[model samples]
Target: MTDEISHPITMDKRVDLALAGAVVATGLLAIWMAHDFRIGKFPDPLTSRGVPYIAGGALVAGGALLAFRRLSGWRDLPGHLTVSEGTEDEAGHPASSLRAFAIMACAFVWAALLVPAGYLIATPLCLCGMMWAMRVRAPLRLIGFPVGFTLITWVIFAQMLNVLLPLGPLAPLARRLGLMY
Candidate 1:
């Protein structure tokens, strides 16, 4: 009875291992690429090579950790799988592959529109579309979350990272509004 009650949820270990392997491979590639990064007389610490090295290292470390956790926890793994994590699927309707595909389609649309439609418009639409596909019923979250997330992303990318994302038509408006800083 206790054995049945304490059975741990599990996914295939090979999947995680493969993902981790890919991450490690990517990290190795990053390190290799960083070796040839040309340095000038003066360059910011993260501008030349630090960002890629940090990102690739983090990915490799995180993937390794996930792979290790998944592999170690495989003994009590389920014979079959449905949801990947937690008991979210136990509430009657389980996770759907169709929904995942729809969300991926939304991402592709957002990427497609990013250059032409501008960040403010394309990001919010993508978020809303994904939320709709995921069946979010709350109106506030459906509306507010995307705007908030997009603004946060914009601040980080534009102000902190100094990335010049294409503003498209909003370029003039933002310029007039003194928002391009």
Candidate 2:
């Protein structure tokens, strides 16, 4: 018998293809929806629809590339896929699908609470939850990373981009602290 192992069609391939298709479809939908945006009265280098168009196009290109790679049997790809690598966790134990589900659930909760709880409150909680799900037990990292990240993003969007993020009950305090105008 030959020492070389055979790689057959597998469920993982199907799942990857399906995800790629979904990304492409989502991109197409974004492009379609962006076309319907109302024209602004003010003249600007980048219009309201520009970002969506760019983002959608990037998604389409990336998804198409991934699909092509998958269809072409990952030719010239650097690494070889092994069953042990895909199935095991960092500790060499069987990976738990529950972690993935928890992360997804956290994201959904974050989205749901974003408007009501505001970015500062909702985002940190979501980040902490995801970190916990990922088995990060350090107290400093769990608190510091999320808070720092949220503040940085808040400044970027609110101050630099001049985009308004819902402050919810923090509006008064933020105004007092000059965090928002």
Candidate 3:
């Protein structure tokens, strides 16, 4: 006979339902907030807040689908996708929640530093920190990946699309380098 797995704490059905419900509720709030957006003074046809509305819509649809799937028994979750606080290693140590918290904290740190450091500097540093935290051991990537990602973003957004990425403290330097408006 085959066994059905159960993890009451983190992988419970009720927990998944609650999470999906929260996502759906948050998405609805996002949609409601987006309705209050006002057109900016720019001549551009697309309003500043237009993308938020689209994102809110996607969140709503995705959350609804998640709720439906979670509430239904039509599908079975693969082993790796299930969360279990009880899982133990050969040393009998439980899985670390520290990694998840560190990743989330890094995002908050990135956002806090973003305005002061600007896209050119902040993004690369944030990417490097995040990669390191995720245990990406490649030295070349640790150095080169952030630079490549930042340059690609700069080219696509600033150079090709003429979008004004936040220059922050690098405004003058970027202007001198012909990388920013």
Evaluated with lDDT, which candidate comes out highest?
Answer: 2
Error of 2 at 20 (Å): 3.9
- In the range 1-181, model 1's lDDT, one tens digit per residue, is 3653333435556776788888878887887798788876686867678877888788788878877876676665455432255444667778899999999999999999999999988999999999999999799999999999999999999878989887888989988988785
Q: What are the clash counts of all predictions, listed in order?
A: 0, 0, 0
Worst 10 residues of 3 by lDDT: 78-87
Q: 1 or 2, which is superior by lDDT?
A: 2
What's model 2's overall lDDT?
0.84
Q: Candidates' TM-scores?
A: 0.61, 0.67, 0.66
| For model 2, the run of ten residues with the poorest summed lDDT | 80-89
TM value for model 3: 0.66
| lDDT for each residue of candidate 3 in 66-173, tens digit (9 for 90 to 100) | 879766652465432345545445585445578668778878887887778777888888888888877887989997999999999898988999988787977988
Q: Which has the higher TM-score value, candidate number 1 or candidate number 2?
A: 2
Scored by lDDT, model 3 comes in at 0.77
Candidate 2: tens digits of C-alpha lDDT, residues 48-78: 8999999999999999998897778744333
